[model samples]
Target: MNQYVALDNIRQELTLRTIPAITLWNRLEARPRTDNFDRALKAEVRDALWMLTKQWQMGEFRGDDAGSPVTSKIHMSTTKLSKYVAGNHDVQVFDDTVPLEAKAEQRPIPFTIDTQKVSLDIRLLMGRQWLKMIASTGNFKTAYVTKYAISIPDITDKNDVMVTAHREAWQQVAATAQRCMDGYELYIYLKSDAAHHAYDTIPMTPVQQDAIDILAGKFIIWYEKLYYQPLDPENNAWKPDFLEYQFGCSAPQGSGEKVLTADQYCDGHLDWYSVDIDPLSTTLGDTGVPVAPPKTYTRSFIPVPVTFDGMPDTRWWTFENGRTNFGNINPGTTDLGKLLLMEFGLVFANDWFLLPFTLDAGSIANIKGMSVTNVFGERYWIEAAGKGLDDDWNKWSMFTLNTKGNLGELTDPGLLVLPVTPKILESKPLEEIRFIRDETANMVWAIEHTVPLMTGASKRGSEAADELRKRYQQLLDKDISDGTVVSPVPVYKADIRYQVMNGVPENWIPFIPARMEGSNRSIRLQRAAMPRILNGDAAKPEKIRPRTTLLREGLDIDLCKPYFINEEEVPRAGTNVYQSYQRSRWYNGGVCTWLGIRKQTGRGEGHSGLAFDQTIPVKKAE
Candidate 1:
């Protein structure tokens, strides 16, 4: 709507005396601050009347009924989580030496399973040490020690005596220490009966026990280090995973202790919020345990305002370069987290304070009440942020555990849990298995991307599956070529007219939806396998089992049983579970080592293209 009174307006405006022409444009300027403090555009009076006026308009001058809290008498109670039980094991002490995360997730090194020696690592490492020990003790003849000797390549230019010893010998004395080893002890560990798990020579002698201890005990101790270790074991310290194993730390002290045995720990990571008190009740899916007793203590401390890296500063006459800019926040209605955080920083940041208090890692802590002494010598008792009827949905607070029980059970108010977990280490996944739901098939597939081999190395699932099938094929070939069979006929020809079922990847172990417990309505993913018909023989069907340990829970038993995963664990989006070697140091500089499982969210559902009752026509030869 441009008004044009052209010629007349120009003549009328020519009579102006003092006023200059006014113009308007979008404001833009080059901002270059070589020196952080630039006073060119800064109004020096910003800290004067302008600040006061702004604060006044925002009601900052409104006097509070009482002065701000200077110190807080925190009456807090804590119970040492004195019990820890791994899986269904007996309850034992919850040692506070190592972080609970390490304890809960640590994998124990089982020496053997009945007749079989379980690990090649145990044999290799322990056998090498045994030969060294023997040589050092002069217990065995030099010839005998040399017979089972193990040698590592000396990485030193020690032309002096087989090059410069084990180089950088000053770093670790053990590295340069001369040992009676020639790598032959690895063979000894494999062949010798003394190294076997069930080597029971009738009338066992002291020498035999000593040999066993050196071979097995030392190997076991290599991974299992005590927090307050004695001189001998500490001296024998070796590299290990982020797992520290102790003898008597498995105990269930109170009601909520059962949560540890549930599926949450199945993946090794412990998320306190998802845990339910009644883990034994399958209906709840995720369970937690309500521990007995509440501890109380009183300590006064000068409260400090809670601060975060990007949080807004209180002063208005300045700009925080990288700090949160509330003005720049373009939050949508669904961005509740961002919106709430921004709102809190802008309006309620001053109301929050932090206190530093230490608690044992496994135990939960609750601040019963707090008496705050203000700057005016006025004391005010403060209640918890969520101090109201426990059943009220509106009452909310952070870090509080949920009260769990059946209906009509009088529930105690949930306590603020401070589980002593730490930011521990996670190595590259040794075994990766993804549990993906196939909605069309009404089944779940445990796709093993990575699998552990017998040689203590990880292999791609596809390659490992191929190797496994090759092994089975070799066995079949050996059987077919046997001379005892008189003109052994192949059960079925490889060039068949029809195929019964479509083949899926051997690594994709199927989990059929089965009735949970006895309820047909409630289904769980029960581990199932496709039958492998070797040499096209339907009668000679074999189980195509999973190679990944996460999917082979109950299959290795004498009587193979179905392993079931909770349906909720594998949701529509799916679940990714991985086992890896973890290594970290605890609070006391004690090395933590373990092989633990970690679970993450999968991308989405997957299609295995698994089909049954298929028909295939014979292909014409070219």
Candidate 2:
């Protein structure tokens, strides 16, 4: 009688019947949601539980399948339990065949030990399996795929290149995965072959090693969550199994899908909170509507974006200011403006003016010195010298449109801006001078300029004694010719950039600018514009221009050095100097304003700086 029901048969009965698990569990005084102990433990429990239930439902152990109840030929050869038992009862038939003294002895088959505890354990395993199956069927849309290719040859440091790419992808996955599960550990193995059959033979650099360390930290958290539950030592079941030997319970099997009571549900949640709940919360109360834990835990290790204001991100975006003693300019806050580089040298006396003052009195030929090419490809020359026309530059002809407003124009003030790389000529011979038609004025001008003359030939001052200053300037000039300039013409590479605007499709973000917002700056783009080199005749030494702040705050001119003074009037011990060059409250004081410099002479290094109330030639950031 005790051997009648095998554990398998009892499991089948529990699955086939409609026994509520919670009800059965309550009746047996067992933890119904025990498998829901921790998110880490859920999947394993679910898997084992489901397998047990399915096996029971399929009647895997029935009759002989349950193992032979008795060893007698009558039972072993019989087809049914009733038939086998009936065969043993045939005493008269058996005695006639085996003799009067031979009698059949009967031994009862014990029932299999399948208890309520075992049934509950199976339910927990079922939950774990369900979770795993769901996880394996993860939804991956094309939109979420982060596959990208790198041009290996384009990168110089192979190690750095690979490390950077790996870091980038790791960050993306970590961030996205958090939204789903507490966190998931990913296995990443690098391969040199497409089949991933062979791994890279190259040694990883220190940087790569560091990147791997970072990734490992993030990866471990996920692995621990995936396999944290303690296995059943007695049953050898990875999930849950009630060990009858441990508790010594022997009730009939009973399990079902029943909703847990409020108290039970709360208890389950409490256990989850007790553990580090990877992505889920550890607390519960009426603080507000109970927000369920996030579906997953995202690795909170997103690398900060390359920025100009923050460390590592800030280094490349900012530059040094040219006017304020070469002060550091915070690109994070500086407004868009022109970066000017001036070049200055001497002009021979005869080469000072472009057109001859008295162009052969009545020459029919147009003056060749003042020709400028317009955007329409037509060349315009000024030949009105001494022919009922003013010699002044303002009185000369002016073309207002370079390319209309299309070529980086500003509607606020009509000024043309042209970018040109700087050059330094220390004492060179005559060469062809390259010139470009100014888009704003259509007038040809030199590329750049610098201040002329030595301030103190006798006693060297701190400012003038900067040897590296001159060397750095030389290096800057050398760099221009070495890479910036393309021979046969003056040209330079434009590496200007912009920021991506918000509200725009991510694919097109680089080309668009969103409505003004503090956060979303524009994207960057490259365009060819500035010229890098210049060609011209060798220049001669020239006198320094009078020093004056372009926009004076309140400096007294009378107290300042005169622009033109007789040498005899100067004291023997000293010479007159501009107030701006001196250390005074009024000199280089107050707010700095934008100014404009105009070419006063064609050949001479002459420019008259003028202050403007408004910005001109406001070119959009390229």
Candidate 3:
């Protein structure tokens, strides 16, 4: 039987396995950072990492699927609060696949079939761990304490169930959210120092506080709407209990003025007036009339920025209260300068990385890597040659239509050739070039690491021309037999542009080159390796990951490079990035230990294998 591990269970498992915590603070000390701003910024980065890990473990942070962990909670009128998951009602209490025996004589069953439903008591353990981690980060701690919730449950004058349910749900939500927050805290730590600076916000800024309030409101509302169900209907059952609870309705005093029906009023109190209700009358004595409350509110608060100094020079900053007065000092003195530089650097990198993908015209095939170098010099690897598109016919023209001429007249339809152009410009004349397979004995020419051709034509249009084209079609059909064909490109040292054309070589669609390479083979080698390195897949990964559907079906190499490299087989480290806040190596030390073979090209660039969330079938034992 296949068992799927739950996110919370995964977290607990990770906690048990790793001795030292792999948090942001610890990572900061591990990696070299020179500036004061880097030190302060490390804390925030740690928080982000912590938040990410915790979120992942708690099911609070979703991956590409974009699903929330909390499922829907439905409310119905009953004297007892009964929780029913919206769709989970279809789940069988016991496996129905097991046969109930029809024994003639009363014999003891061979296997135990206990039907007792064991309740899970994971709330306290999960909550305590999460709260402690989040509290380590001052920013997260502030957000949590300020926006914490208290449960409200129903009571039968003397017996309260709603109160208990409310408290339990609140505790559960808080615990899960705290884990997510801790993960985020840790994620920030794993990020580069420069990236941390760019998103740096004023510590505990009111805007941030307001954001926390909004999130708290949203999550709490989700919990109440999805997890909390009302048990009492009549006033005597739990009406008094609901109204008297400390965490009861936050609705205004006249919230139920228009709730004419008893049902509406009863549900309204429990649901905080979210139930249907008409607008109050706005006339002289109506509840909707504007009456100022006893308290007045104002938004005119200006707070100063806080600065912490760890530098030793006079040029450094001296703070009186929250304000800092920077005297003329050198670079190492004031923390402000470093913070400013870090922030600016982060912004620049963000712009560069988030730049939109723009298609370059001219040579689409070249940019997309559909062209390959063969013994015929550099040629666009066309898997199949079909009749060109007749403007009148939106469908593909038949290969036999090559007999048709330019203006509906029959002429020698010269072989409809697929164009392949090199993406380089060299002053030297084209001479002495040999495009052959590397590390193979045969004279077989594989287009961009594709399967070898069965036949190679010595002349362009001899008796072998027909045979070559036939072989090409055979390979084409075989490659594309499964599904859509995507083109492939030859290895290049630098980025070249290409435009795709007719589907060829099984799943491959062809493309025209944008910038043709120069006739220099040496130059091509440099460009080829550069792109491979940039892609986080070094020349040799200990284990080459299986090709994805796109790659397996022959997607254009250039287009697939980014997607493939991103889908590397490198395993993820288990420790939370924000674990440093715990002040224990057990929580943060091994956070990124799984990233053993780091790609040497750039910082923050590394191989990412298939994520844990992807579902792949496991082979069953006989």
Order the candidates by lDDT, highest first. 1, 3, 2
> For model 1, how does the per-residue alpha-carbon lDDT over 1-622 read when each residue is reduced to its tens digit?
7564445465446565223352335897877757566676564674578778998897767766537778888777665554554443444445567666655655544323322222334434554554565454335434433444323333321212111121222223234234433232333343466445412332345776566456545544553462222222222111111112222221232343323223243444455654445423322122244435546678889988898766666665566657556778899989888888888877776678888897655655656677888789998888777665445677676655444543533223344343444566677777898878898778988889987543344667776666556555544555556642233444444455555577777888998878767686987667788876566342557677666656666555678666777677777898887778777677687777666667778889889887677655555556
**TM-score per candidate:** 0.66, 0.11, 0.12
Q: Find the number of clashing residue pairs for candidate 1.
A: 35
Residue runs of model 2 more than 4 Å from their true location after superposition: 1-187, 190-479, 483-622
List candidate 3 stretches off by more than 4 Å: 1-139, 142-179, 182-190, 195-199, 202-558, 562-622
**Which residue runs of candidate 1 sit more than 4 Å off their true CA positions?**
1-60, 64-66, 70-74, 109-122, 139-220, 226-296, 300-335, 353-363, 373-379, 406-421, 439-442, 474-496, 516-520, 536-539, 609-615, 619-622
Candidate ranking (TM-score, best to worst):
1, 3, 2
The count of residue-pair clashes in candidate 3 stands at: 104
CA lDDT of each prediction against the hidden true structure? 0.56, 0.22, 0.24
- Tens digits of per-residue lDDT for model 2, 1-622: 4344335565666777644441335355555765666775444444667776766776643433222111111000001000001111211111111111001111111011111011112222332332343332233212112221111221223222211223332343334332322111022232122333101232455554455445444444443233222111112111101100010000011121101111111011111111111112111212222222211111212112221221221122235333332124333334433111101111121111221122111011111234433334454443433332222234323312111113332211111111111221112111111112232322222221121111101112222223313433344445556765333432334444232221211011011112232546532211111211123212331222111221111122335322211222122222211111101111223211111111111232222121224323334546
Give the higher-TM-score candidate: 2 or 3.
3
- In terms of TM-score, the best-performing candidate is 1
CA RMSD for every model?
11.7, 49.5, 39.8
Error of 2 at 523 (Å): 22
Clashes of each: 35, 48, 104
Residues forming the 10-long window of minimal summed lDDT in candidate 3: 575-584
Decoy 3 TM-score against native: 0.12
